[model samples]
Target: MTTTNLSGLVAATYTPLNDEGDLNLRAIPSMVDHLLAQGIEGLYVCGSTGEGMSLTSDERRAVAEAYVQATAKRIPVIVQVGHNSVREASQLAKHAQAIGADVISATCPSYFKVSDVATLVQTMGEVASGAPELPFYYYHIPSLTGSAIDMGEFLLQAGDRIPNLVGLKYTDTKLFDFQHCLELQDGRFDVVWGCDEMLLGALATGARAGIGSTYNIAAPLYRRIIDAFATSNVEEARRWQSKSIELIRTIGKFPFHPAMKAILEMRGLKVGGCRLPQGRLSKADAASLRNELEVIGFDVEQAGGLAPAE
Candidate 1:
């Protein structure tokens, strides 16, 4: 099916939870407001950043609905429904469509590991079929999925098999492969860049949009990069991209997602810590992170236009 391509920054949002690790659905509205205020163009809910795999079917559905409702059609909300079980992922895709998600995306089953391109196509096709009416994007994050089939080949084959297949959230750092996907069939697929740090490289290779977690905490910085790139200010773009790498590296020192949630909390959103396996940031670590970010010139208010949480 034909669909409008996604452009600009789409935040792979964090799923808010309470102190007990239960879904804190109440926090989604303010999170959406905060991202929009920071100039995010779309919301990608239940993706890796949102701990989609860590959550159960019921919880994923709840999180998707909350984000979709809070966004209120002001921006597109692409729900990521990838699961180990293709059936479950498809069910989530159907639910996403039923709940009014703008698009549906899924990763190949990670546990069993998709063995080849054709198998990968069949797997994703099942998931995309669930939301037949909406555009479908294959979440091609091979690092996590361990299914490093040639994406260029996969697209060539899946294009006809998966009718709703629009493009990919190309996450790997292979610029050549990414460019191949972009130029495939006269750029038929709307391949969105997934690596936040390599966005400038992707742009040079013709990326029109990016879906990333850092955008939640630092959209303004990235927007400057986009603006500089668009204006052909190569030096300015590099400067901004370097700052983004610095910010990401600083957050990387701690538990990444937890540190991100802490930044959001510092900025006034009640986005609690991540679930187990990616646990919460300790108060001491949070304070230390604050100092580190300050040294890097990352003021939450200035960086994201958010007021400090009371």
Candidate 2:
């Protein structure tokens, strides 16, 4: 099996919208750098947490382009180009490659109850085949995709069917399957944790990385966890990884996407509020969030002034 340097213990951030509800494209690069600086080895460009399903195709393309240009070869950028439309997904994949995105990943298209398993596999297979030049990671989040299948079987078949397929983002809560996939597909694929809450457990398995939403705020914890483990500081890594999960509980309690945006807004980037149907944080909620950040040793006032590094 060919190797790809794409196991990403990454933070999936929301695309900030202005108060006017337009995407704050300008913030893309710095947010990218901030995560990388905080010791995120890699990042997933657009995911459910990114409001990817909420953005228009043109908006998605523009965001991907901005990330590519801003990073300027700084780190790997995995663009999430999955859409309900296969053609659109393929188009986004092609565009992502053209713009110099390092890897391409997509979740299973969730239109209905997933039709059948083969259809599910075939859909992603098409994407893998389409962007044969770039490595692809299959994203598994049954809650978001409404489909379930044997990940082990999928990877076994995927290896043969898709020449460039290299990884999996196991997001579902049932991690035994992820572990099984990790063991079964070991050396054939890189398995990244989709659920941030269980990152340490994922890391404990052969799985070495993650793609999570909460890392946007508490990236320091991620760094410590990985570094501690690298130095064989298992006890320290466990403590830090547990802290990472505990920190996420508060952020996770907040309707997730918007709360992350509010933190970014507090950081001085004008990423917008969630459009209608997605609510913004109330002032009281924002204040409480700030307080929580302080409890976690973050300086809210200082945070408001710093620009997220590009």
Best by lDDT: 1
Across 227-308, the per-residue lDDT of candidate 1 in tens digits comes to 9999999888888888888889999999999999999999878888998899999999999999998887778655453222
Model 1 regions lying over 4 Å from their true place: 303-310
lDDT of each: 0.92, 0.75
Report how far off residue 151 is in candidate 1 (Å).
0.3
What is the Cα-based TM-score of model 1? 0.97
Given candidate 1, what's the lDDT at residue 130? 96
What value of lDDT does candidate 1 attain over all alpha carbons?
0.92
Error of 2 at 116 (Å): 3.5
lDDT of 2 by residue, 210-272 (tens): 787777766666666677777887888777766665556666678667777778778766676
